[model samples]
Target: MLFIKTFTRSICTGKYSFAAEKSLLAALRKKTGYTFANCKKALEMHDNDLNRAELWLKSQAQALGWSKATKLEGRHTAQGLIGVAVNQYSGVMVEVNCETDFVARNKEFQSMVEDATKCCLRYIESQQKPQENVAKFSLDTEQLKGLHSENDGKSLADKLALMIGTVGENATLKQGLGLKTCEGIHLVGYAHPAGHVENGLQLGKLGGLLAYRSLGEGNDHIEIAKGICQHIVGMRPTKIGNNDDKPAPNKDEETCLIHQEYLLDDSVTVKELLEQNQLEIVDFKRLECGEIVSSIGKQPLEFVETCQ
Candidate 1:
C-alpha cells in the first residue's frame, strides 16, 4: 500500500484542501480540512492514500456540522449572541437584531420578527391542549413558508434574509421559547411600546396583557387586573408573592407593591385590592426581552438570573 496526498485552497472562507491517490503523478481525489496548513501537511505525508484522504474530509465535515446546527435555529451562542425569552403562558419571544439602528427599525424586518413570534406562540399553545398523545405536536414547517412573505407574500425567514441582504450585515433570531407550564397560570404578554424588537430590549417600553381565568369575577377584578398591568410596567416584578415574605404596604401610592396597591390607585397595594374585593392573585408574569428587573420570591426590584 502507498500513501499520496494533494493540496488546494478554497475560494471561500480561505480554508485549505488536500488530495491523494495511488499514483505519484496521476489524477487524485480531493479532501478538505479546517485549515490550509493542516491539509498541506497531510498531503505531504499521505501522497497516495485516497481512502485516508476521504476519511479526513468526512471528519472535518462532521466537526463543522455541529456549529452549523446551532446557527440553523438562529440561536445566539456565547460567541454569536442573540436574545429571546419565553414562559409558560405567553409562548416564545424572539429578538432578531442587526448591526445598525437603521436596520433594526426597518419596517419589513420588524414585521417578520413579529409574525415569527406569533407563529411560535401559536405553535406552542397548540401543542399543550388536551390530547391523548402529547408527542404528536411539533412545529409545522409549512407555517414557516409563510414567513417569507413577512405577512405579505414572502415567508418570515425569507423576509429576514431580505433584510440581511439589504442591510449588509448578519441578521438572525437570537431567541426561542419552550414553556414550562401553561395550566393554573395565566400569562400576560407585553410587546415594547414601539412594536419593535429592540423596543422589547429597552426599559419601560413593554406592552403586555394579562391572561387570567376568564371566569366570573367582579369589577374589582378588572381594577386589580389594571393594577397588575401597571405593576408589570412600573415595578416589573419577577413573580407574584405570598404574604409571608414582606408586609403589604399601608398605602397604594407606591407603584411597585402588588399586594398593597390597588390597580386604580398607586396608593394601594394588591393587598388592598384583595381586601376590598375579596380576591387573590394566583400568579403573574412580566415580559422583558433584555434586562430582567426581578424574579419570583424576591425583592422590590432585582435582576433575573437567567432568561432560561
Candidate 2:
C-alpha cells in the first residue's frame, strides 16, 4: 500500500509539471511575442516565473534593437517628418529621420516623432530659469536622445531603437528647438501637410516657429503672426533679416527669411510685410528633415532599403 501511494504521488507531480510548463509557454508567448522556442528558453532561464521571463525578453529585445540601430549609424536619413508641440507659453519643433518616405508616413514612426517633440518641449520647460528665455533651449542628437517621453518613461533613444526594429531600418532624432514667448511676445507655429496630428499637435515634413512682438494696438497682430508662419512654411527661410541690411553677396535667396516674397502678396517682401503689419520678428526657427549633415560635416549616401 505504501508503494502504491508513492507511485500515485509521482504521477500527479509529473502531470502538474507538464501542465505548468504548457501554461508558462502560452503566457510567455502572449507577453513577449517571441517564438515558442525562445519563450520556452526564457521561461527555463527564469525558472518559469512569467513576470521574470517577460522582463528578460524585453531586455533582450532592447539590446538586440540597439545593436541593430548601431549598425545603421552613418546611414543617410533624408526622409522624415517635422514634429511640433506648442502651447500659449512655448513651442517645440523636432526633426526625426528614417531611410525612406514610406517609413516616414508610417503612423508608428509619425507617432514616435510627435512624442519625441513633446518630450523635448517638456524638458525645455523644466529647464527654464528665472529671467531666462526658454526659447534658448535646443538639443542636438545626443541631448534629444537622453530626454524621456511623457507617454512612456523610456528615453527617446530607446523609442527610436524600437522603431528601428519595427521598421527594419535606421532612425534618428536628428535635432530639436524650442521657443518661448514673454508677456509682449507671441509665438506661432506652422506645419505643412497640415492634416497630420500627433498627440493632438500638428505635424508635417516641414515646420516653422515665429516669435514676434506686436507693435500695433489691436489683435490683428495674431493674424499677422499666422501669415508670417504660413510664409515660413512656403519659403523655407534659413535666417531672418531686416529691410535696412544689404543682401549678403552670394547668399541663397531661398534661405533668407526677410528677403523672400510674401505669400500673402508676392509683390511685397517678408520684411515689408512685417513692417506694414506692425510686427517685428524677434526670433524664428525652421526645421526641415535631414538638414543636419551640414553641421555634422559628413554627407551620407542616401539610399532606400528594398527587400531582396
lDDT of candidate 1 over 138-179, digit per residue (tens): 122233434333245445555555445444455554343323
Please tell me which predicted candidate would have the highest TM-score against the true structure.
2
After superposition, candidate 1 runs with Cα above 4 Å error: 1-92, 130-158, 177-187, 194-211, 214-227, 248-264, 274-279, 292-308
Q: What is the TM-score of each candidate against the true structure?
A: 0.46, 0.73
Error of 2 at 103 (Å): 1.7
Candidate 1 Cα RMSD after full superposition onto the native fold (Å): 15.5
Q: What is the lDDT, from 0 to 100, of the residue 83 in candidate 1? A: 24
lDDT of 2 by residue, 1-308 (tens): 99999999999999999998998899789876788988988889999889998888888878888889989888878898888877766778888988999999888798788888888778756654324222445677888888887765999989899778777788888887777655667788888877457454777877888877778898878877878987887777767765565765654455678877788888887878878888878777777766654543232211121110
CA lDDT of each candidate? 0.43, 0.77
| Clash count in backbone of candidate 2 | 0
Error of 1 at 157 (Å): 4.5
Predicted model with the maximum lDDT = 2
